[model samples]
Target: MVIAAFENEKNLPLNELMIPLDEDGIERSVPALNEKWKDSRIFTRYTSFPFRANTTLVEEGAALEQWFSETGWFVKDMEWLLGLEHYRFWSTLVYNRGAIESVVSFTQSAVPYYLAGAARSSPSVFPLYSAAHRATLQVICRMITQRESDRCWIGKEFLGELLYKHYLVSIPLLFDLLPVYGRDNKQVLTLMVQTIFKLQPKYGQDLKVGLKFLQSTFKTIQQQIVTDRLDGNIASLTRLNDLAIYTLDCSTVLALLVECYPDCRSICTELAMEQSITNFYDNTIVVLYKNIHAMDNESTYLTYLNTARMELLSAFRGIVNFQLETVLDNPQRSLIPADKFLCTLTECLSDPVFVKDYQRHYPVEQDLDVLRQACRSVDTFKMDFVQNAYCLEDGANGLSNGYVEPLPEDDESFGEAAGGVAEDELAEAGPSTASGPVLTPEQQIEANVQKVLDVLPHLGDGYVRKILSRYDDVEQAIAAVLEGNLPPDLANADPTEPYIPADKLDTLFVETGIERLNIYDGDEFDVLVHDQIKGVMKKGKGMPGQPKNLKEMLDDKSHVREMKGRYQEYTNVCDEYDDEYDDSFDAMADSESKTVRLTAAMRNALVDELEDDDEDDAEVEEDVGQSGGKKTLDFCENPEVVRQRYEESRRSKFQARQGGFVPPGGGSGKDVVGKAKGQGQDKSVLLNRKQKGEHKSSRANHNRKQGATFKRNKGMIPS
Candidate 1:
């Protein structure tokens, strides 16, 4: 049936092809397979049968390859088979093994092709691909689990080859398969962890994929730890720390991966906080410090440093508590080199470079206090431990007598002690003592005063002087500071000049000639100045009537309208005079005779007089017009007599002008208008006179009694 299936490869069902097995269900010998099968034509035809068609065929094939291993036929022919671009065939080979060496060798040799096929496989055929993936993972896991103790190293070597060569392809496969493998499968989990550790030292693009795979594996471990409540897994912790240290070594890769994947940071943080793992805490601190140092973002650096600091504190507390417990439990073993640990921790916490960098970025007080406390605790512990250790060492050395022979003066120890004392003195003296003579008390005081003088510019000179005078001694200074006493100058300062009271603020504005303070009473001024004043004034203590000021009185819309109206009236009067003056001046300048010319000042005087006369005439006309014909008998005898007198006076003036006789008032028409011919009295004056005469005539006519008669008189005429 197998031969027939191969003969009709295109026609027969691929599943029907299977290797012939004996009654025991083991693969039968394949003696018939020989040199002829090694040829390309026969090999390709034989290997074309699908390996997944039957499990027996895969096992039988491996047996056949083993049967011909001496002739090197399988090795020569399997190369062509592996090159056939068959995922199922390779998966089958992975599923069924002949020799460990042959299987591992074949798998390693075919990893690149498998990865390429997996990469090229379509999503539609993902089920088939997943089956192949499962088979591959099971094969690797089996090889690792089934290996002998002496040959277990081969498993790691094989995994390294697979991972380092095919990291990109393996990453997705591992991620997809990790959850499927589950934490229940300890062997597989161990193999996965071992595979990650092997890939740690690798560099290049593959290292990043390896890191992602490791991160995913850590997440799996984390979940398992949570699910199983495995608080302390030393092996897992060690592996995690190893991975972190490896990542730290490749800082650029770690930074890129952590930045791209925030979970990487969480994974690292978890690994660092794993107290079960040896040196995990310290490793985490170093890694976090390195990451913070490398990071440029202030916020990210602060976040990392804070986490590290918390972990450091926890670690310190644990170490101290553990040491104390150890001492309580076994005094002899209590000497746990805690002083060294404390010293190392102290050095790390007090790293001047880190302190400078940290302060440069986030100079918060609480964070600073945290570091100081850590250092102080370490210092106190170290001091106590040193004293205890010294007494213990002396007691152990049988020096409890308290009387010992001193080393000879010229002995190396004595000389070294002397030198150390000298160095200590020099260190305590400081750089200034080394560079210059020490200052006396007076000189030190003078220096302090000079420093105060330097700062006096910022604090006003008067204020600083007053403070100095009040706090003459340390006790007074302390009392003054405690009481929050102000300087004498400020304490005695007048309040009125500093801030204008609300009610009187408007007076200030008025004095400044500002008629409209309300125009400035908007949010713009409030933002620029008012808000600041309010802040300084404090709540409930504002300048009496602040904010409202004179806005209510000055900003009244009705008052604004009245002022506008008055301004408009004044402008109209001025414009009217301007026009009249301009016209009069032009007329005078155009006259031919120099006698009629008027200087600018004279012209202005004439314009003013004319304006006054026009106003008076208008007033008089208004009164007479409103009164109508009603008049007191004493004020006016009769309207007809009054009209006759006005007509006689006008006739006499006209006759006088014709005869070249100046009026008794010494006024002439020529002086008012011009002496030139064709020019009569000023048109404006003439118009005014005409209007008045017409008004009078109309009034007289309206009041006339038709039957009444009157006699002409010197001052009156009858009508």
Candidate 2:
């Protein structure tokens, strides 16, 4: 029969004949068990028409047919299989590499395609439908693979296309097929829902169609509840988490739809207000809470609820919040008309009930005395742990290595000890001051550090071991002496000194414990500063320095939190601006000249910023002569100089602004049109540098044309 089907076809390849041809005269490469049958009268007669009214699918089918004719779909072909598999493989790699949200959507879309062959109508309809499903999957996989998270504008454009063409019609149609394959195919069905949701999040109206399908699902469940009650088939009649998921999905769909189509709120409001449905949702929440508290006994029954708890909570929370805002406070003016419903939802969220549920997980501490004791214990533990592992004498590294030095001891105590060292050391060394070319202060510090290292071995094994074990002591010592001058005799001492006077060192250490704080590690600080510079280069604020003044901290939280927040906000703003700029770029990419000009300008600006600290302040003044004249008057005041510079630049740009003029490629409508026109014409037709010489020679002729145009325009004036 396969041979017979192929024999009737004009295309010579039997493989090509097995695949259905789309209406566009191209071979459909997708696998089909009944290619001949789908084209025949039996299947199309019933399922064709109003059910398949989407023009986009029709056009896509034509395009698919043409593509398939070029490359046949061979299931056994390794290359072909790999090509299809590439989408998922790349998406997984990207997901693992920290591309979070988009990968979730991409992976979800593949689920339905995997189930297509299984979800068919008998043997007759399975082949053609499966083939079409596979084709759709291929396109989906390709689209997902190509989509980068950074391409937000491209996503918007694609979404507009999908909405306009109604490419979204396939989603709900595909979702409807899930149940037909049976409950055993639950994984596939779940995946399908997740994928559809992810891909179509922007298309809130399209999602409404899927939500409508789910609403019907609810009706079916309600019917089953009544039927089971009457027929003694009832197990537990309460709504499960799966029902909640469907409800949440519907709500999410409806929420977005409400933004696009506010009327959906009215329908949902009416349905939710109905006493029976409200009772059902309330009962569902109770069941959900019960399952959360006691899922061990009823594992199978609560499985769906347990798996979808987070989603259910989100939906309920949103619904409750929405109801509270729209209906609770302003009952008379409420558009939803479900005051009681809103009240119930609010009570469910607010009460001792919700609080109790959370408290089960995170119990609140009420006794202040006990809390104080507990906090002290925790602080003691932290101090002990850090001290043991990271004492200044132990030479511990910084936080990245899981160590923090103990706070410095008193400087007054250390000062007394240093005095003893100075006297004792001077008596032994015989006033070691230099007469010829004295050692520098830095040289003296290096000499002292070297002397410490040399004596470290001989300073008793325990002492040597403690100092060697911890780098924190060195950090503390450096911080302590950074401000104070060392003795001239010690500074004049040789770089390599013996281990004789360990007693004097204890004096120096005691005197130097003046609340030592490490400001920045030379290399580590640069890394932080570099990141801040990058933020500034991206036109975002640099991270704030530590808060010494109350005024700065009063801007927000504490010094630490405020600085961290500024860093985060800077990164976030850059991210947002990048998205906007990329969108602007993509919008202009098709217009070649504008993209080139805009890209060059952006690059030039970035380069200038990198090279010049005050590039932003370097806008040249229009009246340099006028500004130069003012320089005789006191220009020494920093504020006055800055203000004058700003004023000068404003004056310079003013004439251009007043003439209704804009710089070339300055993001204006006229500029875009001009650039687009310029890009469209061939470069050879445009005047080049070589042609410009001849054009300049003909300036008189050009002037004559301009003069004639001006004369003609002058004649057109009414005066």
Candidate 3:
């Protein structure tokens, strides 16, 4: 009962903490054993670790070596070491500081033994030597830990001199032993690190140095992964796992530094320490997670990489959660950079392949919830950020790979728009083909353009293609062109050609022309109707009436009077126009431009102040209200200078585009009408005849008079 009560006491108040002090304020010597209980006393289980009145540091180290080197010796050292929590009963441990040096030597010696046990890579307890190493670690940690009894603790001024100056603790040694044992056992390591700050808060700088080295190591591994350095190697998994361990080890400890040491959080925030773990999460974990399927035969090693990813994020959350108000010197600013953390999650979570397993093990939503709760607690959250962050609508919504479900009608639309449906969706959607082998959309579009161009021979091929691309239906585009309703850009094209061919001018009015010319085919209107009201009769050609000549067709203006009311609505609007002023835009314009309204007294004061101020001595900028930004006079450039600058900028951008850009091949078929097959025919006719000829039987029209019309003499002006 006495031993249990004695061992369980901890976290005592500073006033309650004490050690025996003599009248001279010096510790009194220990009295010898009582006479009656001397021989029948409690057996000393750790006699091998004997310490006496005159043991030197060298002698103690040798004793610890002897005790550890021999197997099956004193196993009670760990127990006795753990019992030294009573500072008053064990004043000699602090006063006689050689035991610290001795334990450190033993801990160092036990490294080889611990490594031997760890080599099995099994989930068993460490070997005896490794256990001893941890025991020594506890002893050292207790020594450095700040005592509740302020009278007995080491002064911060002498802490660096005694520990660091003597080379007892360093970044290399701490990290070496730390990563080795810390993989399974972090409590001991955590204790030691915490004690380090308790002893001297300034050691946070040393911790930062170690963290920097780890972050650099993490970056190197990330770069190597990005470059696929281990792609084909047999030992790739092993090498990668080792690298992950090395970097993740230090990354985790960074959080420990911020957590265990209070001042270091602010110090590290000044150094932007959050980016270390944040970058590791982004560049390493997220990258590897994305490419996990590629790790085929070596997935086990990559599993640890995923776990390391979660660990890194946990550290990130911890940093953000523990951020000091003065970390940014602005209390309202969020510690979590939403762009890096919150929005990135939204992007990564959209892929069910990643989210399926990730959500299963580490519920990303829970972490986000924790962040939300933390923000509310700290009063530093962005509502827009929290509201926009990704979340599972139904727990099972995105688990399976399927046709993409549309983004939920939720609040997140205000922020990062959810990623689009899969990029290959169009490729998967069967093309415009009639269900044989499917053609690509591009091929279908090209075929459609040629079909439109074929029937509209007067239209430029370029114009037809433009029309086809805009309307995406050959029939509709052809119909629109036939109705003389081309879109604005295609309006410049000559849809109607001249009736006379320039090259055939000599035959325009020859003596045999009117008598035997067969240029006029049949009248487009009914021949009976043409005979009743229009041009010459067609009885000369063994028909009821002759086709109207270009001259007679132009002179027929009967249809114009039939469409007389087309513009009446527009004319009425013009006739009703009145010069009325609009005040609707006044309020909107006032809001957009700065409008300062001053009270009468304020205006008088402003006038007085301006009058008192010298023009030469006036300030260049003034504190602006409402806009919340400074109003400064930026010198205006001369128009010529502005023009030169704009030109230079424009030229540079143009050069860049020209250097790297490849324009889409021109699809327009302009100016192919009256030229040779390649040079004279309009793109419409050339494309229509040539391109369409590939599919249909041009054998029937092979003997037709193709270019004779274009080569023949054209009519005089229609009128």
Candidate 4:
């Protein structure tokens, strides 16, 4: 207190009297505690003197702006074990050089060292290299998604910083060649991809960037292969094998996309809009065919050739199935004369290796038989063409069907991520004979029951049936039963029936809609596509909310809205033109009266309030004079606070703090105004200061970051 009193620089914006001056005091003079000075933990604690990076400079400078993001009140003790409050923690990240950019620079620099031939061969270097690599990925993920919880994934507004500012978090950064992101760490790779997915709709100009990259990647292979492996020079074909690793990453991205948007038309709409995706499917299939016959059966470049082959085939099949199943408007949808699906396979027929592998792992014969059965009733296509497609029946053009070497058995799901009913579910529903009768919903319930049993066979049939009856979906019911998590349903009723449909009529009173009943053959096609689905997917624009961390919650932008309100008071001023150049008084200087005047209503209200308590003689005094030159308070923008003051003012003994009373029988003591305005130094300051900043909080508007004391934070923290 004595030191503060002696300080003559009290009026300065960033005066250091007692507490640490800005961040300069962070440079502790104590030799014994030098280590503590470097530690960021020192600042998070409450301190009398604290500061923040100047937001104006950050917003204006193009170079510095890219390295750092706009800091908010999110940094705190909980996120980092150190007990630093938001202001201290945020300043720590931005004050010294830059943390985010530094990490990026380090990662970029170390990539070459790790990729060097010596580092690659050295057993000792691998662990260090691997740890460093994973750490870099973790840092990238952390920076992009600051909030660790699920509820608020990557903040929507912060996404702007990621796209326009930080160049590290990009699609090419992860999905490019081995030199860029060498080791195939599935978890780390998935995290990077998820970051892109979350950033999408906004993140890199997003989905399109990733899509274009994948499109080019697939196109590259198709371009390299000149119709056949032999046509391309042997060297070029061998070079195609180099892309084996790259395609594996690309295939993962496509598989995730398929899983995210289960509907083929839906994803196609996102990638190419209403345009036919036949070419898109062909690009992938062409890449697969290239990989199948590329000079070598296996390459050191691609460790998981089998996995890649299966993925490529799976992604291609999904795309083809979508084009075939959807009631597309394109003329190519009519496969009556020529099957484009078989054409993609025709090139493969020449290669016996692919034929045997395809037959063994994922048989073409079975898939074709299923297609024939599905198209049996629909009149959309000529079943004869599909039936006559001999690509499945024959040795497939010169290739021999006799298996020379058997491929490994399929362990993973043998279908697209979002494929038809499971085997267990179908079995319980009972086999469908050629002349079998239609099954009731109860029979469908039986199918779901068996599906649950296949996974959790320990549970009794009755329990699975009850669960299936409660929740119509197989996955949902099984999940609920395993986790024992249930949400309250208002229309709860225990049904005696084994199965229940979600949209079906529970009682006769509820009328069944035609769409729901679907008396017409449910071909799962023919629905009108409102628009050619185009453009990258955006949030709340038909993009599915993917399952994220269990703890994730929706981001609350209320604070953002609140801060936005405060800045609106001076948005135009930042643009230029002298904001203080008010000319309202230019013409009124001579005509305007010097004396402040009140309206008739104000004078009348004042007189009435100043009247003596004698009810019989309630006549207000005439010529109610203005008291002690007290000015009327400016309007407060806060509706809630104004309402509160208005309520308090109407109290019988209402007494204001700022308004001085007029002499006897004049205006009432103190003002009865709904709200008081002032600079708001403190609660006591309210008695004297008028015209309070309506947007400022009670305690030093944002720690004076925007107050009269605002200054640059660079010099404050010691270098």
Best by TM-score: 3
* Total clashing pairs for each candidate: 0, 10, 17, 16
lDDT of 1 at 567: 88
**How do these models rank on lDDT, best leading?**
3, 4, 1, 2
RMSD of 1: 31.2
Candidate 4 error regions (>4 Å)? 1-123, 146-155, 159-165, 174-200, 203-205, 221-265, 268-308, 318-377, 380-384, 387-719
Report the candidate with higher TM-score, 1 versus 4: 4
Best by lDDT: 3
Residue 619 in model 2: lDDT: 33
Better of 1 and 4 by lDDT: 4
Q: Estimated TM-score per prediction?
A: 0.19, 0.23, 0.37, 0.32
**What is the number of residue pairs that collide in model 1?**
0
lDDT of 1 by residue, 1-719 (tens): 12211232333222222223243455453322122123223221111111221111222355434433422443443443344322233233333333223323333322121123332333433343343334445545543332333312223454455444533224443333333332224365545544454444453344355655554543443354344334553334334333433332222223323333333333443333223221322333333333333332232333323433433333333433333343445544434433433343344332332322222333323322333344433345455433332222111211111112211132233435545435455557787543334569755444433334332212333344345556665445435534767666656753122222245446645655544445444334444335553433335634655555467647656768779977887665443346788888889887845667899999999999999899889877786789885433466488997888886777577667654434444433433333466666666556656665677556456445421333233335643
How far off is residue 28 in model 3, in Å?
A: 20
lDDT per prediction? Answer: 0.39, 0.38, 0.48, 0.43
Tens digits of lDDT, candidate 4, 1-719: 01111222333211111223223435222221122223343322211111111110112244323222211111232234223322232234434324444444434344331123433544544454454445555545554554434322334555535443445455444443223343455445445555555555454345456666666766675565546555754545445554554555556556545543444324443564212223423344434433544444333433333445555445555655564554233433444312544444444444444454445455465545554444443332433333333233424232221222222222122322326446665466666621133458876666667666545544566556766667768999878856766545412433223333553323322543334444322333313222334344455534465435444435645668899989998866656665345565554675675877889999998787666444324322221233334445557668897877775555434334434333243343433243445533454345423534443366665456543433444455343
lDDT value, candidate 1, whole model:
0.39
